[model samples]
Target: MSVDFGQIRRNEHLPARIAAQIGSDIQEGRLKPGDKLPTEHFLAKSLGVSRSVVREAIAQLRNEGLVETRQGVGAFVTERQSRTIRIDEGELFKRDSFRDLFQLRIPLEIEAAGLAAVHYKEADLERIDEALARMTGSEKWTDEGIDADLAFHRAIAEATGNDYFALFIGFIAERISLAIAAARARVELEEIVNVTIDEHVVVRNAIASRNPKAAREAMRAHLLGAASRVDLTLETY
Candidate 1:
């Protein structure tokens, strides 16, 4: 069966949008299991995007277990039974899923912050500072701001010296960022952006000081504040 690929109009989150489009094609049976996907060059040309965007989209599908690449060949759809944990981005923004996912995220990130405080190298600190600086400098409620926000969290996870922590946090943060961007769209108040930047600064300072307790508390506080900004009422501990 031939897949009907469309031109990508929006510039923001190009890889994610492409991944979603191709994933929908798979789920709807336009692309069947074991069927090889078009080459990166073909997809880029058909979709009016760069080859790098197609590559990133394919990477996302691979991470979600929807596609597998053969060495020196091409990517193919995976059997449904062999697929791993799949997160539907559309469903994730629903209120219950958003709140529940945020709850699960809290403790994992708090622990990561503590571990980062103890384990972070100078380079890790520099990465975190750079992300924070970008967030502080960006326009309020923009995609660039959101990307910087996620980068700050990802940097902290990387600093933990645990590959699993970085992996899991990176996965969760990618999904959660979609919901966060949606929430920001709804509430585009300058005050909220200022508060978020302040919260990140506190977390950065705690980690830099090598204070595990302080780092954990700062992370918890920042996350809770984030929930409030999104109008989510998560149970506070």
Candidate 2:
């Protein structure tokens, strides 16, 4: 059962284009969770791109939480949206909507941060680092950077070694992207970008040091900071 990927058009961002096509396949249910992806070699040949391009595209998909790769096994579609709450776009634009999303996330993600600090494997740390690098290097308010920011949080969720944590956070993050993008659009301050980078660094460093308490606090503070920047408040939950 080989996947017949269409040939890619010539583009400056080949990997992104390839990733979009594969992501579309997953979204459309042409690919389902646990379904194995075509081998990099096969995808490269069929798509008329280098293996490196395919590899990068796969990495991008992984960051987007649309796919996962095993140590010796190949890539597979991730479990996403199987039990997701449907978010309404009109509600997502409401002034308080982002805060509502964060309120639900804070407890779960705080626990996830602590658990990740205690349970994270070396590869999990590497994935987190890679996502952080992408966010830090990206242009402020760009979709690519926002994707990386979301990826950073999803990596933390995965590091908890709980599949449900990853699955839930991945689904939630996808929905919240609409709000984050809208919030970013209204910002006039460039300092927001630098602050975000520093905040992520704090969380990353705490997790890397294996300090569960510090990781939890850092994660909470970061999320709180994000809410503050967006003019949202976190009430007692």
Candidate 3:
């Protein structure tokens, strides 16, 4: 039976709602394992939601281990009982997802920052600097600023001289993008924007100076500040 996307109403929780419907489809075998889901654009149009909403819904499924995404191809249901690992809804942007996402980043990124201090190349420094410049020059709390923020962290991950580190951080960043967007919406924008830039500058400077310990500490401090801004308590996570 064809899914009637038109019946889905628009609401604040649209992405979660969409994810639930698709999840129900998967569970019922209407969308069997290995079946390719509709294109993001098609799903967006059909559901009367933006492409980002569709993307987020798909990302949610991916986190749940209910779906797999192949580059240049669409998402497909994961083979039944094949998921060895899965992130539940609480680990997403729902209640404490941001906290969980930040916790996931702490160890990995702290290590990356240290490695970047030890191993970063001139080109890596340039990319990081460029991202920082973009953040400093862009409007506070805008989507562009958020992109630049993610880019700065990604540059540090790349500087680790490990393909796996960059790849892993990139994956985590994609999953957390919506969480970051939501966090950005809840705070005093202008204040947080300037503060975030300053925090980044500290991290960048430590990396530039080739101080591994300092870089690690700076990165830790930066992330802690971010968590505080979002009202996410990371101590327990």
Candidate 4:
């Protein structure tokens, strides 16, 4: 039997419940990155809700940056949260069962990126763009490049309507910075830096279109790719 969390209704909160379901799936490893979710009709049927409700729920998850839906490919798990990421001296060291952390973070970042695409106030965009510009301007390496990179992510988190996301992401900033450093060092790809700006642009465009699914997908790709770098670097460790 399929599971559902669709009882949340008027005088209720379907979106939150839906978010919880998706979030739980990631945490439990029931869903992996790039794994497609049940279709709207299937989800609606499983959850005992109208297709509109399912879509709304999916949009909420997309807004949270957890799942991405293709135009006709249904919804896929773009990213998942990690359980632990203790960064020290610019390295992303993983703790036990670290999968949980990514599981938690994916949805949040995706939502932030998506919202940034839409609600990213001009000032916020300018702030991020400035950070990007600074990153590009630096031909020489400065440890502070990490700060610029993080600032860009913070901008996306801030763009989300939910203040909690910004707060949560801020709490994890130190470790995330370390992770970024480690990943960048491993990939050694300048495009990672350059593409950040481009990927952000893709995410921004999706949100601007109010295409939550698209926004989530873009965010997911960026993050999962980040995770892949971690995998690559781990080989040397």
Which has the greatest lDDT? 1
The clash count of every prediction, one per candidate, is 0, 0, 0, 22
Cα misplacement distance, residue 148 of candidate 4 (Å): 1.2
Compared with the true structure, what per-residue lDDT tens digits does model 3 show for residues 66-144? 8999999889999889743444433463544545676888889899999999999999999999989988885344665
Candidate 4 to native Cα RMSD, angstroms: 18.0
Model 1 ranges off by over 4 Å: 1-15, 25-83, 139-141
Which pairs clash in model 2? none
Tens digit of per-residue lDDT, candidate 2, span 8-118: 112124565587688889889999999999999999999998786687678657756778889888999989863234354345445566457768888888899999999
lDDT winner between candidates 3 and 4: 3
Cα lDDT computed for each candidate against the true fold: 0.79, 0.74, 0.75, 0.59
Q: How well does candidate 3 score on lDDT at residue 157?
A: 94
Please report, as a residue range, the 10-residue window in candidate 1 with the lowest summed lDDT.
Answer: 1-10
Which candidate has the top score in TM-score?
A: 1
**Which sequence of candidate numbers ranks them by TM-score, best first?**
1, 2, 3, 4
Off by over 4 Å in 4: 1-92, 189-191, 195-197, 205-211, 232-237
Worst 10 residues of 4 by lDDT: 1-10
Q: Compared with the true structure, what per-residue lDDT tens digits does model 1 show for residues 80-197?
A: 9987667877566456876788888999999999999999999999999998988888533566676677779989999999977776776677666655555555554587688889
Model 3 CA deviation exceeding 4 Å by range: 1-91
Please provide, for model 4 over 1-237, each residue's C-alpha lDDT reduced to its tens digit, 9 standing for 90 to 100: 111111112112343346557767865788888788888888878887767557655654564566767897787876556222222211223332233455567777877776666676778767766666655667214444555555567666777756777757754543444455555554545766676657656765676576767988988887776666555212110
TM-score of each: 0.73, 0.65, 0.64, 0.52
